[model samples]
Target chain A: GESVGLHLPTLSVQEGDNSIINCAYSNSASDYFIWYKQESGKGPQFIIDIRSNMDKRQGQRVTVLLNKTVKHLSLQIAATQPGDSAVYFCAENKGGSQGNLIFGKGTKLSVKP
Target chain B: DVKVTQSSRYLVKRTGEKVFLECVQDMDHENMFWYRQDPGLGLRLIYFSYDVKMKEKGDIPEGYSVSREKKERFSLILESASTNQTSMYLCASSLGGSRADTQYFGPGTRLTVL
Candidate 1:
C-alpha cells in the first residue's frame, strides 16, 4: 500500500540543542510536503512546507529539506525548547489527488530541561 | 487567528450508535477535511469537502460519511460506531489551491466507543 513513514518513533534531546526528524514517502508523484507539530490533546499545527520544485524551505526557527531522489523529507528545529516537545508528522500530497494527504506515522520529540 | 471549532472536546458512545462530529471554521476557507489520529498511525484522512455540498472520500472512509451543507461547517458521521472507531478526530481547513495549501486545525474531539 502507498504510505508515508518516519524513521524514528521517538527522539529525546536536551534543551537548546538542535533536533532533526526524518520522513520517507512512497509516492513519487507527490508535489508538496508539509510538516506539522501536535502537542498533547491538540490537533496538528503546521510548522513548515516545501514544494517539489525546491529542495529546502525555512521558517522562523525551523527548516524543511526535501530529497526527491530518495523520496525523503526532514524537519529541523533550531534551539529546541521544552515547549517544542510534541509529536511531529510529515504529510505529502500529489496535485492530481482530490486534495487528499498521505501522512506518516509521526516522530515523538521530547525536549528535556 | 483562524479558529476551527469542534462541537465537543470529548465524547463517549456505545457501539452500534450513530455519532456526529461537528466542525466549524471561522476562516471561511473553501476546503475542509476530517481526519482521525491514533498512536503510531499519525493522522489518517477520513473525508474532505472542497465546497458546499462537495465531498470526496479519503484513505480511511470506510465507516465514515460527511456532510457539508454550508461553507463554514463540515460534519463527520459514523453510521454505526464500533469500538475500533475510538480515536481522536481532527478537523482542518485551508484555502483551495494547486498546492495543497497550509491547513488550520481544531483542537480535536476524542471519541470513546465502548
Candidate 2:
C-alpha cells in the first residue's frame, strides 16, 4: 500500500548544530512534497516544499531534498535553536486529487541549549 | 496570510454523543479537508470538499462525516463519539490546483471523548 513514513521517532540535537530528518514515501506517482513543523498545542506549520522536478529547495534556514529514485525526502535545519524543537512531518501529494496531502508520522526534534 | 480557524482549541465530549467540529478559512480556498491526528499515527484524512456541497471521502471516513455548505466553512461530524475517537482534529484548506498549492492549517481541536 502507498504510505509516507519517517525514519526516526525522536531526535536530540545541540543548539547551533545541524539537524536532519528523513522520510520515505512509497508512492512514485507523488509529485509534490512538503515539510511542516508543529509546536505543542498548535497546528502543523508549513516550512518548505519541493516538487518532483526539483531535487532540492532551500529556505532561510531550512532545506528540503527530494530523491525520486529512492522515494525519499529529507528536511535539514541549519543552526538549530531551542525554538526549532518540535515535531516535523513530511507530506506528499499524489496528484489527480484536489490537492490533498498524505502526512507521515512526525519525528520529534529536541534542540538542547 | 491564509488563516484557518477551528471553533474550539479543546473539547470534552461524552461517549455516544454527537460531536461537531467546525472550521473556517478566510482565504476563500476551494479545497477544504478534515484530518485526525493520533499518537504514533500520522494525519489521517477524514473527508474533503472541493466546492460547496461537494465532498469526497478520504482515507478514513468510516466514523466521520463532513459538510461544506459554504465555501469558507467546513464541518466534521462524529455521529456517536467514542473513547477511541479522542484525538486532535485538524482542518486545512488550499487553493484548488494540481497538487502544487500548500495547505494552510488551523489550530487543531483537541477532543476528549470520555
Candidate 3:
C-alpha cells in the first residue's frame, strides 16, 4: 500500500533554535509535495512546497527539501519561536490525479522559551 | 481571500444515526475533497468531487457518500454513524490542475459518535 509517514512523532526545541521535520513517501508517481502547519484549534496552514524537478524550496521562515531518490522530504524552520510550535505535515500530490493530496502522519514540534 | 467553510465545528451523534457534513468553498475551485484526520493516521481521503454532480471514492469511502449539487458546495453523508467514525473531518479545495495543487482547508469539524 502507498503511504506517507514521518520519522519522528514529536520534537522539542528551544526558541531561536532551528527545527527539522522529516517525512518519507512511498509513491514514486508523486511529483508535487507540500508542508503544512496546524496550530491548536486551527486548520492546517500551507507552509511551502517543492516539485519533483527541484530538490529544495524556501519560504519566509521555512524550507522544504525533497529527496526523490530516497523518497524522503524534510521541513526546516529557522529561529523557532513559540508560535512555531505546532503539528507539521508533509503531503504529496499523486501524478495524474487532479489535486488530491496524500498526507503523512504529522510531527509535533514544541518550542520552549 | 480564498476560504473553505465547514457547516459545523463540533458534532455528537449516536451509533446508527445519519450524519451530514457540509462544506463550501468561496474560491470557486474546480475540485473539493473530504478527509478525516485522526491522530497518528494523518488525513485519509473519504471522497472528492471534481465537478458538480461528479464524485470519486477515496481511500476510506465505504461508510460515506457524497453529494455535489452545486459547484461550490459538497456534502458528506454518513448513512449509519459508527463509533469508529469519530474523528476530525477536514474539507479542502483546490484549482483543477494536472498535479495535486495546494489546497485551502476549512476550520474542521470534530465528530463524536457514541
Best by lDDT: 2
- Which has the better TM-score: candidate 1, or candidate 2? 2
**What is the per-residue lDDT of model 1 for residues A9-99, given as tens digits with 9 covering 90 to 100?**
7889999999999998879999888898989999888899898999999999999999999999999999999999988888888566555
Clashes of each: 0, 0, 0
| B-chain TM-scores per prediction | 0.98, 0.97, 0.97
Assess candidate 1 and give its lDDT: 0.89
* Residue-by-residue lDDT tens digits, candidate 1, B1-114: 889999999999999999999999998899999999877567788899989999998889999999999999999999999999999999999887555777789999999999
- Quick one: ranking by TM-score, best first? 2, 3, 1
The C-alpha stretches of model 1 lying farther than 4 A from their native spots are A1-8
Which 10 residues in a row give candidate 3 chain A its minimum summed lDDT?
A1-10
Q: Per-residue alpha-carbon lDDT of model 3 for B32-93, expressed as tens digits?
A: 99999876677899999999999999999999999999999999999999999999999999
Compared with the true structure, all predictions reach lDDT values of 0.89, 0.90, 0.89
What DockQ does each prediction reach against the true complex?
A: 0.44, 0.54, 0.56
DockQ of 3: 0.56
Q: Positional deviation of A100 in candidate 1, in angstroms?
A: 1.6
Cα displacement (angstroms), candidate 2, residue A73, comes to 1.1
Candidate 3 residue-wise lDDT at A25: 85
- Between which residue pairs do clashes occur in model 2? none
